[model samples]
Target: MVMFAIIPYLALSAALDPLAPIIAGQLHMSAQTMSLGSGLGNAAYALGTVLAVQLGLHLPQRRMLLAYAALLVVGSVLTAVAQNAAMFIAGHTVQGLATSMLLIAAVPPLAIGYPRERLHTTVMIMNMGIFGAVALGPFIGGLQADADAWRPLFWIVTAVAVLALLLVVLTFEDAPPANPDAPRDLPAIALAAAGSLAAFLGASELTSHSFLDVEVIAPLLGGLALIAGLIVYQYRAAQPLLMVREMLTSAIPVAGVVTALFAAAASVSATALTASVLSETYGPVRVGLLFLPELGGAVIAAGVFGLVIARRSLHYLPLVGMILLAAGILVFRLGMPDSQPLALLGSALTGLALGATVAPALFVAGFSLPSASLPRVFAVVELLRAVAAFMIAPIFAHFAATVTGDLNEGTNIALWIGLGLALAGAALGVTIYALSGARPQTPDLDTFLAGQRPAWYSPPLLSRLRRSHDLDDLDVALPVPESVD
Candidate 1:
């Protein structure tokens, strides 16, 4: 199950490497326009996540996997055979939807099938595959683009999808459905989706345009406001979109979110840096060869973290990995020579960091959620990471382009950013470890509910929602309100 999930992530990211150049040269399009293809695809994918929650209600998990895999195959085939750039972009847009569906389908098996003790470790191992593919995909796809044609890479990805489909059918079995009596908060769900979209769109715009620009600020602010409102509404409502009470009151979940941000930024920075350096410095093919060591490292990290590590405190491993990441990036940026062996070692070190951190961070995050909440939790974090990778990477490129007026200089600048992000992540990891060791008593969901009612509950809707749960009911959950005193 783990290996199958890993394959889809690997295959999807492979095309991301060849996409920009292929669109530019083949389509005769400008960089800005080609970038839109990525933005649109990402937005579609984000929206698809909300749809996944509903779809899970109606469909069998294994069947959903098969259907979504078929879509990926179709999308890949379309991309492989595309003659014009429009056709190619369309293919990717569909691919985004298909991949989102695949991601949603995979979550249940991971969440329900695995034991809680192994959950974090399993997730971390899976993430290593994900980041490994992401780190290495660009190099390989870029090489193929240089050596032959970019189109064939799509066919290769399609083959992998077929394999994943077979694996799903063979290994996955559906669990009992959620009780129909459980309250459905459609309004909250819609708000959550809208807020997520606005935030992502806004964040993506932050790099390309001014924060004050109408296109950017309106969406960003609107998104933040909407998400805040969703939390407020969910806090008092009968049921919630994200089970906010459980998330807020638990130190584990809070720690999970922090770890996710740090780990995601650290690992993603490497891929973005590689894209800038390899595409400009060595040509795509040599860059592909350069990443081989990184791929090997990722495989090793996945196995060691996933299969061998038994410690619940394994969250600290990523902190160690962050230190290694900082050292590796510094070494690579400062020590790159003409020698192939030297370059390979630098790449290997970078890969090792990615392998070590990516999975472990994801494991910790997902471990804090119940099975039913896994998709929503994973979607938010994964989507945030994706947005960060796409939007922020270009910022580094743009900074390099603006300041040094040289691609190589720009890559070095990006490396510095990568190093800073890694160090920051390490700091956060240390804080979380210290906090966990302190063993501060967490407030129970029911205790938080028993606090005196605020004036806002005078409103009919809010008041009605609040009445649904008993003030002293031990099991009642409560999300943090938008404004908490």
Candidate 2:
């Protein structure tokens, strides 16, 4: 189930990236136009999460998985045979949507259904499924790109989708919906889809139009407004599509979401920018080689995550990850090196940061909520993350192409901004840890969400200040708002 759900997306992502230049040239499209397809595809991925949750409410899980896999096969076929930009974009968009639907539908069960002793195995699987595939993407794409061919890669993906369909049929099970009678949230779905499409369209426009262009600004602002409206509506809905109120009121979940959002944005933007700059100076193959270290880093992170989970030190893992990410971003800030060795090192560090942080943050959020609430939680987090990570890439890419009319200069500017975001994410992780009074080895998810300080916790700075002011005798417990159980 895991391989069926994850491998195709990773393979497709890997193939598309290195082959992008060749694909663009062959199809008579500009880089920005190509980016539009990727942007929309990712937007579909984000919106599909909502649809998956809604469908899961009304359909048999295994049947739905089969349907999604079948659609993926169709999508891959479209991409493989595409002869024009429009056809390619349409196919890739379908691929993205199906992948996300499969993801939200499949992964939560794997996370929660397994035995407690095997939770680490689940984490390792997730790490490998996601980051591991991403790490391998460049090598596969580079080979195809170096040969100046893309159809073969798409054909390969089509075969994998077919394999996934077979797996779904063979492994079919009869798991009931979480809420068989749950009403479809059409309004929420429409709003989410419209918002994601508009936002991505707006960002894609930046590639050809200035940031202030009406084509760019209106849809972007309108998209954000619609999303804000969705949040307000969800907060007040009788039976919300997502647990907005609960997430808003919980400390750990909020922290986890923020960490995931910023980390994704920073990491993805950096990779896109660096790849564009370096790939131009060096051929696609060398650029792909530069990122091979990411695969190594992801493997290392999976091992580290296994150790952390075994020791019940999940709470501190994000902090460690953010620190590494900050250091990695700083490496890029120094320069986007033409040197292969330097570029390899930078990619490895950043990949390690991504593997260490994003998945662990997700686990933190998952554990913080009850198993029953995970679908909604995962849906909302994936929605926001897709927006932040995928949408931001085109915008950053656009600026990198146009900022000073020098790609290298534009890339440096983007890297500096990415560095700032990484540092800010690290700072936020620290604040969440300190304010929540979470410990390194803590295993109680509820305690963190409830904002209950561990027995050994003391507000180090606050306590010292209080003693200095002779106010240490007064009670100083931080208040935690009541959250949905």
Candidate 3:
């Protein structure tokens, strides 16, 4: 069921770049519009995530998963057959919602069902779908986009989605235990979904233009208000949809947010900027082909990091990725005037960097907090990353529009912007690693989830992973033992 749930995103993420140019051509719109569509899809995905968290509390898990998977099949068809931009967006939205719900619902059961010691590794492997999609999606989807019209690409997506849905129905058998302590609230879920959608739209719009405009201001402000209300309601309501306390204080949540920002920034910047420039420079077929090395790199890196590297040591992996990304992007930007080969090399390096870093970050984020909090915290972080992807892409586009005299010039500006983000994100990762003290490794999840503490405590799981990877011990800054009683 879990694997099936992530299949659409895997296919979509890779295909997104290739698909954008076709959509733009058909719609007779600017690349910015295509960028907006990407943002919209991500925003819808985030909305689905938030809703899934609440759905788990109130609804039957087996039924919800089944419904979600069915939606995926339908949404895929809608996307494939869409004649206009509106239909495309609608299809993307439905897929986004279904994808999120399916993915989120799969987690809690795993947490409760699996042994604590193996949870981190288990989740990490499962999350490879995100990376797997990124690595393989572009190549497979790109081929279709290259050979046939873009419309056919949707058919492919539909087929994959249908297959996934069927697999889910066959595989997903366990049902969640009824939680008498947790009550469901319909109103709260609705408010959160609406607020998230508004916020994503508003945030995304801000990238292209000023937030001061009426169109931008209204959605942004309204979304903020609704989200604010959500928080207040959660705090006061009998049964809250979000696990606010755990989300804020947990090491995992903090790390996840930071990780998502950097990971998303790296991959999103690469794909969006590359798509925009390459569509004009190389044409769609070549542009899709350009991502081949990237896919290979991401797959190899993710496999090694997930399978071979210990979880704790993986924190620094993203940092390493950022550095490679910066280097690749810098090379691509500076060398663009020189040759296509240079740009290709740069793309390869960037793909390799993303491959190495993104999966590990997600693994850490997904497994860090308690099982109960996974969906909500992951949703929030994913949402923030969506905000970044939407907000950053248009900024790059607008910069290209104003500063550049030509497509190449605009690409240069976008590349530089991407490099800057990579550097900044890398630096933040270093700071986080330094602050997290070294602790001995434990095989049990109880240690990580242990809210109770002795008078004196030590650093948690991060340090253990770091040491296992032979990284230097981070200095202890906070008290080791947190007092629970």
Candidate 4:
């Protein structure tokens, strides 16, 4: 059910790049219009994370899940049959909104609600469902473009959405609000909506305008500022919607988050910019074929993650992923846009790198916090990730296209920057572990599942470097441990 629910949207997100031209032409839409639709849809996705968390706190979660799935069906149907730009945009926007809502509603319970023995399987399935779909996207996109048709793929997507809705019906169970007494954070929701809209709006304009143009720069900067403001607002709120303060002040969670953000930002550019260059020399189908190994790599990574989820080795997974990511960038750089073998190998490695990094880092972060707080923790991590990955991809693509007169040269430059980010994220992660005196410990799932404490012990950030005399000042920075009744 989760697989069907998530795969269609994610795969299509990847495929959309290839299909955009055809769809735009057939619908009498301009490039700018298509870009705006995509951008707004992504903004809705980003905003939906916060809204989902808030709604879950005070509403009947299962009922809301049903509603979200139904809306997804409506969105998919509208998109599959759209004749005008407005219909397409509206449908896509709704799809994004509903997908994120379902994500928050579904994923965490599967993470925490299950028994200890099933944790690995649950995580592996989740990993494969999400990243595997993403890895498979380019190939699907390429196939659709090669056929010179977009509606067929969308119709297929609509079928999958329908399947997801039916599964929701079959799996329905009664569940009450998560915490009826939790305060409604309307300000946080507003900030998320505004920030996401502004940032994505600015980024989408890159399809036509310069980065510094008023149409692009003003909203982009304003959105960024708002995002920053959101972090601050959440950190200080009396009852925060997400676990910003808890994760930030802890060493492991901080390290995990940094790796996740940079890994996500770097990984998207790996495929997009390189694929753009590849498109110059190869047809859509051939380029897609070259990238097919990406999906295989993602599956392998999912298996490996399953093996290590409950072990001390999970702590090292993100670090190892970063190394693989850098090596993948090197592969793409050596061959640039021309070597078919290099494209095959580089895409696989990058697929592995991405599969290994983001989800594991999220779990690492989740394990550091109380089990009960996992959902809220996830909401914040995903919110940041959506911003970093989605926003950075367009910016990086634009930079690669415009930074140099030669497209190949510009792509090489972007690949190097990606390599740097991967290495830097790894370095920062290691430094945090060393400075905070964090050690890899097997997660205590028994206590963690009881919601009494974290799966592993995480030190306060920089606490090891502080003198014993100053310990009192940092005590307030520590999370008050939760206890299960």
Indicate whether candidate 1 or candidate 4 has the larger lDDT. 4
Tens-place lDDT per residue, model 3, 194-222, is 77677667655654566477756788779
Q: Where does candidate 1 stray beyond 4 Å?
A: 1-15, 111-128, 169-176, 183-238, 307-309, 336-343, 369-373, 403-410, 436-485
lDDT values for all models: 0.60, 0.78, 0.64, 0.91
Can you give the TM-score per candidate against the true fold?
0.77, 0.89, 0.78, 0.96
Q: Kindly list the per-residue Cα lDDT of model 1 for residues 340-454, writing each as its tens digit.
A: 5655776677777777775565545554554456666666556555555544554555555556767667667767887888888777655644544422222221221222221
Report the Cα lDDT for candidate 4. Answer: 0.91
lDDT of 1 at 98: 72
Query: The CA-based lDDT of model 1 is what?
Result: 0.60
Q: Model 2 segments beyond 4 Å from truth? A: 28-32, 436-441, 444-485
- C-alpha lDDT of residue 294 in model 3: 71
* Model 4 spans with C-alpha error above 4 angstroms: 468-485
lDDT comparing candidate 3 with the true structure:
0.64
TM-score winner: 4
- Candidate 3's TM-score reads 0.78
